[model samples]
Target: MNIYFVRHGSTEGNETDQFQLPTIELSERGLKQAEVLANRFKSIPIDIIFSSPMMRASQTAQAISLVTGHAVNENPIFEEVNRPTAVRGRCKSEPEVKEIMKIVKSTFTDPDNRHSDEEDYFQIRDRAQKMLEFLSKKEERNILVVTHGEILKMVLALVIFGDKITPELFYEVKRTFVPDNTGITTIQYDLSFELHESGWYVLGWNDHAHFGEF
Candidate 1:
């Protein structure tokens, strides 16, 4: 089984570095980026297309669906990290936003800590686990998932480290890895491998070769 994980295209919030609103859609450039991404999948056979229910991800998935002729399945599991409502639509550079972000970062040391309505580390970890399980149960051999950056990172970490993953390690990975808009990350599962052998292996990460110079 080949699982293709793709980050959604750029949004106004992404371009401006603001805390994204839940209903935010893609920017004009982001729409073009999605079309380029869809073209990249023209040669690759995708049996199923799954996307975050958020508008940005759905837009990206729809672009691919138009090319691939597969209906998109919108699932909440692929949604971006549940940030505090207070910061939604706010600029990241604002003092209030900065302070909130600092608190959020500090809480990463403790998985159970929750500052407000935002999802804690443990919640995201569990969601990542669920996402893997969901994919494993799917009958489709070629699955394409369009999601947001933070959830994509979580899913990758869960796949790479399994039960051994810790909050600190995840924090480090998140800090080091910034998935580009419409970037594709792939992982493959070999049915021949035993449970102990861990059949899943990462084939690629953050691949954006489809967009030449843009």
Candidate 2:
């Protein structure tokens, strides 16, 4: 099975570097980016599409579905990491928000620590595991999923490092591998390697060459 994960396109909050609200919709450039991304999918054989229920991700998935001729399945498991509600729609540059973010980052060393309503390291990690398990059971050979950056990062780290993925390490991976809007990430799973391997291989990550079309 080949899984293609796409980060949702940009929103107004993205342009302003704010902690976006779940209900936020994509910006004009983001919509165009999604269209460009879908155009690239014309050459790939995608059997099914899945998306986080958030508006930005759903809109991005819908754009791809139009090109791929596949209906999108909205799944909450693919939603962005549950961030503290207080930061929603707030600019990251604000001193208070910065302090809150600092506290949040400091808590990364503790898997169960939570500053507020945000998802703990362990919870998000387990959710990533569940997502992989869900994909393994699918009959489709090619699957596409639209999600947010943070959870996408979590998924990649969990797939590549598995049990060795500590909270601290995950933080670094998240920091170093920032995914762009509409960037495509691909992972492959082969049944033959199930016995001796995780059966998952990172074929590609954050491929956004289609952005050149804009």
Work out the TM-score per prediction.
Answer: 0.95, 0.95
RMSD per model, one decimal: 1.7, 1.6
What 10-residue stretch in candidate 2 is worst by lDDT?
A: 105-114
Q: Clashing residue pairs, candidate 2?
A: none
Q: Candidate 2 — which residues are off by over 4 angstroms?
A: 109-113, 194-196
* lDDT, candidate 1, 1-214, per-residue tens: 9999999999999999998997999999999999999999999889999999999999999999999999999999999999889899999999999999888878854656756788888889999889888898899999999999998888888778878899878987899989999999998878676653557768899999997946
Q: Tens digit of lDDT per residue, candidate 2, span 1-214?
A: 9999999999999999999898999999999999999999999999999999999999999999999999999999999998788899999999999988888877755756667878878889999999999999999999999999999999999878888889878978988999999999998888687642788878899999998999
For candidate 1, list the clashing residue pairs, or say none. none
